[model samples]
Target: MDLATLMSKGLVGPLTAPPAREASFPYGLDKHGLHEIAEAAYGDRAAATGFLLAAAPRPPRRTILLWVTQASTARDMGRVPEAALREATGGKARRLSLVTRHATDALWAVEEAVVSGVVSHVIAEVDSADFTATRRLTLASERHGVPVTLLLPHICEGATAATTRWRVGPQPSAPNRYDPRAPGHARWRVHLERCRAAPALVGQAFDLEWNDETLSLNMVPGMVTGSPAPGEAPPHPGFPNRRTG
Candidate 1:
């Protein structure tokens, strides 16, 4: 008998097809499958990358992260500060960095890591990727059940096979609660450009906040006249390493 017939006869537990996409969290960033972040011209690509790293669901223990970047990105944007990464991950996850001269090589490394099953996650920063490249990465991610995030520049245009595409740019942070002059919590003006999971959500823009204290990403209301922006955090500075003399 066919599997459906067997199920009707109670010979097997009820069979159901898997979901086309993973269950998404509040914002689209937590998507378990592949994700892509494309920055606008002169956009703060580093911040978007860092947010993805910080916002990613903490991976299981004993697996490290694979980070691939193009040489130009490294030279122009510079690498993420170790202190910043440590804070973003809550000091639990470790990362392996791989710098490639070409965007293709960087993308290749991302795919290899996704299918290797050695690392828990793969995050790549490249200038651009074509549809074929993204499609391959998506298949590998689904097959391996691993998550991969690609950070691209504004130049990265055209169609793609990624699960979601977010156009991220810096936005004015909320007014500081403690020190009004100081910058408040990290905020971004985000556009959910494309989504295979929730296509209807596309075209809408969201003001997002990265809460470092809780290490969570939240969608807050946009700024309004004469009012503190949403998702403002208490002002604080980086902790010192040693006691003051």
Candidate 2:
């Protein structure tokens, strides 16, 4: 059958374009639609989660966020702590979480949350989603004016109807100025695999740092070097080197 015929019969997802408007990186992502953030590799889900939390648009006052997670993803990555959410969102986030037994259930929950008109935003972590599922989410988010973000595993691939797709990986954090032995603010290497808002920027990559003090995410020049900043001592050998939060 033809593509249009399949869509009409609910055998395939219908593809749609985002609203026409000038859009820029970062902020433009806040537009009403579905976006996907996937891990660059195994164990990079933490980095992807961190990026989503730090970069997601702040909801208007009084509206809470809806977070949906599939069982497998939740068991592997664990839930975000209340303190971490407070720190990441600068204490402005009021969140409701839901755990589903399967990816289909998680996707259903996301769509329901979007159409419910109760949540300011929706975030979901699922094991996988095909193009049809993503397209449904995109349509719901755009129609309801509620933004949705999907956190996917590294194995996620192939076509998707999301407005944008980002692959995030952890990077060595900048040196700690207060104490060189300690880890500083978290950093991530974000690669834009696909972008409907800015097609030309599809393959661009960015090195970003999350500043907890300023509650902002900023792009840095390049990867941080091993040398410490002026007046700071080198990292101590006794302390184990690990990824920063």
Candidate 3:
């Protein structure tokens, strides 16, 4: 066989590009994937967790979701209360919460759950995960067709192999319709630090509102608010003399 003939037969200088990843999970993730949610310097980490809980791919009606968090994190941030969880997910997900003493153990449990295939989703709240550990989790998640998320603190830096990395911060609540002093809907300022699938949206910022009634995350171009002037009223010290006839 001649060199030219071998070349014609496609001995190949570089391999062909792999097929485009199929859409298996919501938000442009393949069947199996790794997503990371990290807090900012003064951002709301619980909001980050709620964002994940509210926005992560919904597996099915009856599938189980795993939540693994470090003991220290549970102490600091406190667990996502049942009311919040219910409000976020519309009481759809059946979550099994587990607390681990160390981050490593929590990570291990995340990997095992991803590989198990029984659980549909896994969310682990650990202090940090190095690139290597995250890479392993990524591989396992991709293989088993399970989606896993790592919720790390603000200090986590450097590179990671996760599908996407988001920095979540709590924004001021939208103005209340009935009461000016009361909070309206939950709002978040989400920064898409990294996105393996949609690199175009990477580094983009999104102002999101979590509508618990609909259990949906809506993207608002700008803040939706109203001035409190229309609802303002001077307090009366003597009697209820505002509007009664």
The candidate scoring highest on lDDT is: 2
Clashes of each: 0, 0, 0
Model 1 agreement with the true structure over 116-219: per-residue lDDT tens digits: 87887788888888988887787777666677888888787789988888888877666677787677777877778888878878877777777777887777
lDDT of model 1 at residue 243?
75
What candidate 1 gets wrong by more than 4 Å, as runs, is: 1-20, 23-28, 60-62, 223-245
Model 3 worst lDDT window (10 residues): 11-20
The candidate that wins on TM-score is 2
> Tens-digit lDDT track for model 2 on 1-245?
89899779754553354455436776345657889999999999889989998888765565688999998888998998888888777677699999999999999999999989798889999999999899888888877778899999999999999999999999878777777678888888999998887888888989888898888888877535333454456567888978999
Itemize residue pairs with steric clashes in candidate 1.
Answer: none
Model 1's alpha-carbon lDDT is 0.75
TM-score of each: 0.80, 0.84, 0.80
lDDT of each: 0.75, 0.84, 0.76
Better of 2 and 3 by lDDT: 2
lDDT of 3 by residue, 103-159 (tens): 999999998888777898888999889998888887777666788888889888889
- All candidates in order of lDDT, best leading: 2, 3, 1
Local error of candidate 3 at 157, Å?
1.1
